[model samples]
Target chain A: MNPNTAWLRKTVALVILIGVWEACADLGYFDPLYMPAPSKVAVALFQLFAQGTIWPHLIATFSAALGGLVVGLVVGTVLGAVAALTPLVGELLAPVMISLNAVPRVVLAPLFVIWFGIGVGSKVALAFILVAVLIFFTVFTGIRDVDRRLVERVITLGGGRGALLREVYGPSVIAWILGNLKVAVGFAFTGAVVGEFVAATKGLGYLLSFAQSSYNAALMLALVVLIMGFVLLLFGLTGLLERRLLRWRG
Target chain B: MLRVDSLALAYGATPVLEGASLEVPSGKFVSLVGPSGSGKSSLLRAVIGLQQPLAGVIETDIGAGDIGMLFQDDALLPWRTAEQNVALGLKLKGVAAGTAIASARQWITRLGLYGLSERFPRELSGGQRKRVALAQVLAREPQLILMDEPFASLDAIVRARVTQDLVRLVELRGISVLLVTHDLEEALALSDVVYLLSHGPRARISGRYEVNLPRPRDVIKARSHPDFAPLLQRLWNDLSREVGERAA
Candidate 1:
């Protein structure tokens, strides 16, 4: 299908679902206070904007996600590269990553909050934890699975370690990095939202918790929609960057 | 001239070439025809430092040009353009980008990729990619080119075209070429001298033939010659026996 038509189809499907939700609420099949209609959520979103209360939460969530993604990406890539290029390091660290990765990162958010407090620091730290293992495995596998002949070819051409890393390893791992980003970007928002839910003074997660406690279903739905929109925006940008960087691979 | 004296090349305990010896005269095409595992590739690898001989001296008497290798698989980088792949040799020589690109394009044209310089290896057909690979080594202006089963992947028609292209290019350049193939016809078709390699604990040069075949030798024309059938049969018998013994 054409990309435009595919996108239009998705939009129409979402509109139909919203129409059903509105009709159900209107007929009293569901309590509007507990399960707000799409219309109620939209009005709640406008009210939040008018009150100027959503900006701080949006900024807080964006900051945590971006900061964590940057740190995780840098450190993960380096660590993964070192593991790939050096056998000793890979062996030493293999078990540690396996064990840590097996544990749900959400299980550690409370620990982060306890240690770093209910601040941006805790949320950022939690997001980093969420993204690091995924990035590391992707990049390490990227480097490890490089073409053996290409490496030998480079060596034959008088290329040293630096050149092998630059030409062969860089190109080989780029695909893996992009593949993992599809998952890791989502994890970044997840880390932020979950961190906010557990303990945070300001953020979408905090709003989610407040909405639940105050029995404001519309506010909660509105915040959830806003967070999903933000995540989708970031995902789209990552895809754009992946396409640009990987154009030559074709 | 090159000499492999008292060479011992093996994989673990299994010897591929033991006490092997060879002498290749300069500026001539020498084809190594042998069974699949008769140390043909090992000899080439050892010469290029891809493998180390247990005992031997691979002496290059006249070494002005860098060694150019055409790998068994073509080995073209998947991400490189036809032009970029050809420019690899020049890149190793540290040529400026403009000069390197121009030189690469010149040889690429000669190698029959005139309009497809910007296409990647994956984009080209098998024969076209092989020609691009040929251009890669030719652009290096090497004193000697070691080709390992370079044309094995091409169909009969494309292979014939590439062989002629190689002959014309070799004639113009006068570079020494060592073409390795299991195909006896290809060996006789291209080389000035053909060395039939025996299976090894020592792979010996069992027999040698001097083609002295005229320029522009066609694959079709060569087959019609009186000597072609006899030559083909001889290689079949020799290489097959060697392979069976190794398998046994």
Candidate 2:
């Protein structure tokens, strides 16, 4: 469990896997047309970046994902707070939200394309739906789950409605939202890519579809690696924010 | 000053207290001691406006804002720092940020938690968290304070020390306190007047004893006082009889 040894073990495992993969491809264990070696994928990744062919797709995807995340967070927080604080609203909305959540959100991508057209708008809308549902449930439950004792303490201190929200429910909800940011990020990305796959002029998902049509396995795997990198970067940023905001949990 | 008369408290049809009454005079420490499930906490809750008394008259010269309460569980906000927790009441009262911070700092320092102002409740020990809770209540500068077994969770030595510090602070500020606890010795050590409540179905004030002990009494050493044993024995006799009767 030593940090250094853990890091070394992970590195060795990855290296061995890639070595075996390269050996199999070089020995022609599989057709290169369908399965490219790790080296070919790496070269394709380098060329895609060096030739700047990936910039537009990357930017399109990033913008759509970021936009959806922001919109979802804001709208979900408002709805969740309303649902938690008002019983009538919760009674009216809870079942509707549950039904929406039960449906496979990905299936909505084609309908969204038909509604919003094959552009960033459709992708943004899809991502918004995905992230909003997640954040709504989390914030709603978090607010409701705030310790009643803490609320009573605040009221005894002469705190009013605003104070209850600010001091008691606000921090609790924020903590819950931050705790689930990793999942939210992944869902947002999935929403954007799925929307693009159904219909889009530009984006990593569009490029992936194009690569599939051409049967260029190296390019397809290269795009897959690129998407993973983007998701990882977002995940890392969210982690940093989580640590800073939840330092009290230490 | 707080006065409750002919108080009847119940949850739905189940009666918890009936004809329970007590008074906390200005600048006096009063304790309510009783067996468990004797409706002590219910009375405190009714007084604090967290619950409604089925029928009672609670008269107080102080406004709700001028009264502070300490919960049995400390109830410190887990996400806020010690200083921020103390500053909460001030902020709620519309005190300026700078003044609230300054006052919070002073209270934290006075409670011997100066360097720990930035620590969260989870990062603090049980004793340290209790001190922070005390600081939080004291910082509000309430004319009257209500405590529901605030130090019940601490060890004997820590509880004694906290009680001493609390007494000194309340005395210095001339704040009246109404404390509820099951610990007979704690009640006798800290209060000028102790009211013992009988066991429930309809708990009522069964007896009252005045501790003629002087002010600034050392709660730890006060037990060894010549007058301490007899008062303790008398209260215990009344309380144990109620408990035994209830068990039967």
Candidate 3:
């Protein structure tokens, strides 16, 4: 639990991962044509960056991911808040959400492609479908977990419905919402990449699919890492905002 | 006057208060003293309309002035400033923004929190939070008040100070209170009358004693008051005896 120990522990994990990858590559258990070495992946990333191919794919995927995140956040928050406060709506929507969650969103990609075309719109739409449910479940559980004791305390002070929501439930649920926002963004990013892979004219996922068709294994790995890096950047920024929201908790 | 008549209260199916009746006149600070699970809190909850009395009449005659209830932890909104939390009740009653907020705010200053208005609940200490809650309640200018062990969470010194401030505030506002507490000295120190509740499947008022001690009374000095020790000893003995009798 010590701060210094945690830093060292993370360093050890990174070293171990790289060490294992290098050892596997040196052993030649797998052919380099099928599985590129990490150094080759790094070289492919540098080559893509030099040719200015990485930036366009980065921009394409980032747009889809960010758009999906925004739509998911707004719609999910509205649904979650409404569902938590109103039992009838909650009961009606609960089953529908479960079914939606169960359905493979990839199966709907072709439908989205037909509806929105093979552009960013189709990708964004597909991502939204995937991300919205993650946000809904997290935020709903957040509101549900609010302390009943605190609500009673507010009510006994003669707080009306709106006041109880504002003072008791809203503040109480912020920690949950923010905690889930990070994971929700990750889900949204995953949805975006999956959408791009299914049918996309451009994006890191498209680049990945294109590289695999050409048997450019290192380029595919580079594109995969780049997408993960983009996800991490957005995720890190959200975490910063989360820390601000929870400063009151400290 | 507050009338709790023929009250039958319960937590789910298990009954707690069976045919309980008590009358609290306006402008008196009364304490309900009891052992644990004696329906003191349940009675307070029933009075506040938070818990239904199952089958009884809890009548409130005065309806004009705003009412306030204070809990042990103060329960201030962590995101709100001291002044904003204090003025929340005014906002809740659909009070006009300009006038209600302006009038509601002067109390924080009057109650020694003049410049600390913008500080959030997390920034304040335990004693300061209690003061904020007190200011919050006082800002309502309630004719009737209810407290569920408001000062029980404070240390002895802070409790004494807050209790003193409370007595002064009550006198200034002429607020009628029905307080629930397990602290006998606290009950004796602040109450004009004390009602003792005994524990059971159906808890009832075991004894009612008039606290003849003069205000503004302090607990340290209360023990030395001519009637204090005897009253304390009597309540203590009765409560112990009741518990023992029940155990047997």
Q: Residue pairs in steric clash, candidate 2?
A: none
> TM-score: which is higher, 1 or 2?
2
TM-score of each model, in listed order = 0.92, 0.97, 0.88
Better of 1 and 2 by DockQ: 2
How well is each residue in A1-250 modelled by candidate 2, as lDDT tens digits? 7986997999999999999999999999978999999999999999998999889999999888888999999988899999999999999988988988999888999999889999899999999999999998998899889999999989998898988998989999999999999998998899988888889999999998999999999999999999999899989999999999999997
lDDT of 2 by residue, B41-68 (tens): 9999999999899887999999888899
TM-score of 2: 0.97
- Report the Cα RMSD per candidate: 2.4, 1.4, 3.2
Off by over 4 Å in 3: A1-40, A102-117, B94-106, B109-116
lDDT of 1 by residue, B1-248 (tens): 77778788989888888777776777788889887677988898888788988888899865534677787777777778989888876787677878889999998898777899998787899998888888878887877888899889889999899888887777677777888897888888777788888876568777777776676566568776787778778777877887788789
lDDT for residue A207 in candidate 2, whole number 0-100: 92
* Highest DockQ scorer: 2
lDDT of 3 by residue, A105-201 (tens): 6678888889998899988887787778877777677788877766875786667788777788777666777888888788777777778888888
Ranking, lDDT, top scorer first? 2, 1, 3
Clashes of each: 1, 0, 0
Evaluated on CA atoms against the true complex, candidate 2 attains a DockQ of 0.83
Interface RMSD of each: 2.5, 0.8, 2.6
